[model samples]
Target: MGFKPSNKSLLLEEILDALGQLTESLSWEIGTTNLDNQTEFRALELLWWLDTSNYWTTLYDTINIGTSYSQETIQHFFWDLTHLISRYLGLEISHYTAHPEKVAEVFWPILTNHSEPIEIRTSALNMLMMSQPTVSRFLTLYWFMQAEPSQQMYNFYYTTINSMANSKYPCYDKYRKIAAQIVRFVQHKWHHWSTGNYLLDYEEPMRGYGGIVQAILMANQRTGFPSVLRLTLVRQVV
Candidate 1:
């Protein structure tokens, strides 16, 4: 006999069906009044997916291009749903206080705890990354500092710097500043080594170090220019 579907499987099918329908009709106005609970849940699921996809530019474009839906309304609804989901999963915002040190203290353990389900930990990590940018920057630099010096460490440092440099958000300035600080800290750590050699290693993966070179040229770039660097890197890679 063919296997019977479990209740969980049935619900998942329903959610997926709902998502397919919603994505097809982006021009439709979204509100709780029109959507039943199941459809709403599925939409939130899709939003969470987009949130973690690391394609901030795509997210911005998809939500703003004459979709006829209220961007603020959709954001508010998504945040509200995410908050509920986090609470249900026992990953409440209240659990991580505003104290920068305390926030990292709580979040890092949860993120690195291999015993927890990956989805839950990822959800928690993304939530922290998006909501607590400053703290996230601190954590990224702090961890990099503590980590062993290696090619992988250098790659991560570049990745973070590049992302901050090319970010399109209004707070890209802040992100660039953070990236600059991290870069300086790293430079100081290896001050005895040749900066030129480090830049060569940085441009190795990208086949050229245009952005890295530019960052070096602009004295003010040290304060906040990784976002620009990241943007340049992405353009060149693309």
Candidate 2:
């Protein structure tokens, strides 16, 4: 059948059904298949009920439900579903006048959790970094120590720092100004990444200074990496 807007009450009912099904699917041998279609459909249905009282609650229920949560899946959900969810949030902000902070509550945690897959955490890191100052220094340090940071990880951290520096925080220059303390924190703590796509050959990685703008600016000063920063960074955030 063709698409038709459900009555508000009916919409709520449909959303509930979908949420139940998604949660059920995630818990079983079913969810791993057709994720693309499932997430797109899931996101669309959620937005249709944005004004309903449990709009965020329903979404959170899906995320927090203990039976099926994992960093890899959560990360996949973001990369797969952020387009839908972020747009939904954007619509809520513009049309529904929803609060960004409410959205951030859910968004930041998923990104900062190093235990989660790198892609999702990277996406979340960029999301919070672009819209707010919510990166977890501890998480960043933890990941850097674990293994090589991906292009995704490097860009997210670097851009986050740069954006903060250019913003109201004038003390951003003080980030790396602490001598090599910050550098050592990253070098000693973070996994030494080998991908030429994310890191520059400069004295330190873009994240070394604490913001991405500084990273890009310094990056501009040298041929640090050949990949497009926006392609590497913004799509994940936006």
lDDT of 1 at 150: 35
lDDT of 1 by residue, 35-134 (tens): 5445556554543343223334333444444234434333433333543453334323433333444445445555555454333343334434434468
C-alpha lDDT score of every prediction, in listed order: 0.40, 0.42
Off-target runs (Cα >4 Å) in candidate 2 are 1-6, 27-31, 39-43, 49-79, 83-100, 134-155, 167-238
Q: Write the per-residue lDDT of candidate 2 for residues 23-49, one digit (tens) a residue.
A: 556633353657545644665655554
Per-candidate clashes, comma-separated:
6, 13
Q: How many steric clashes does model 1 contain?
A: 6
Q: In terms of lDDT, which candidate is strongest?
A: 2
In model 1, where do residues sit more than 4 Å from their true spots? 1-106, 117-123, 135-141, 144-161, 184-238
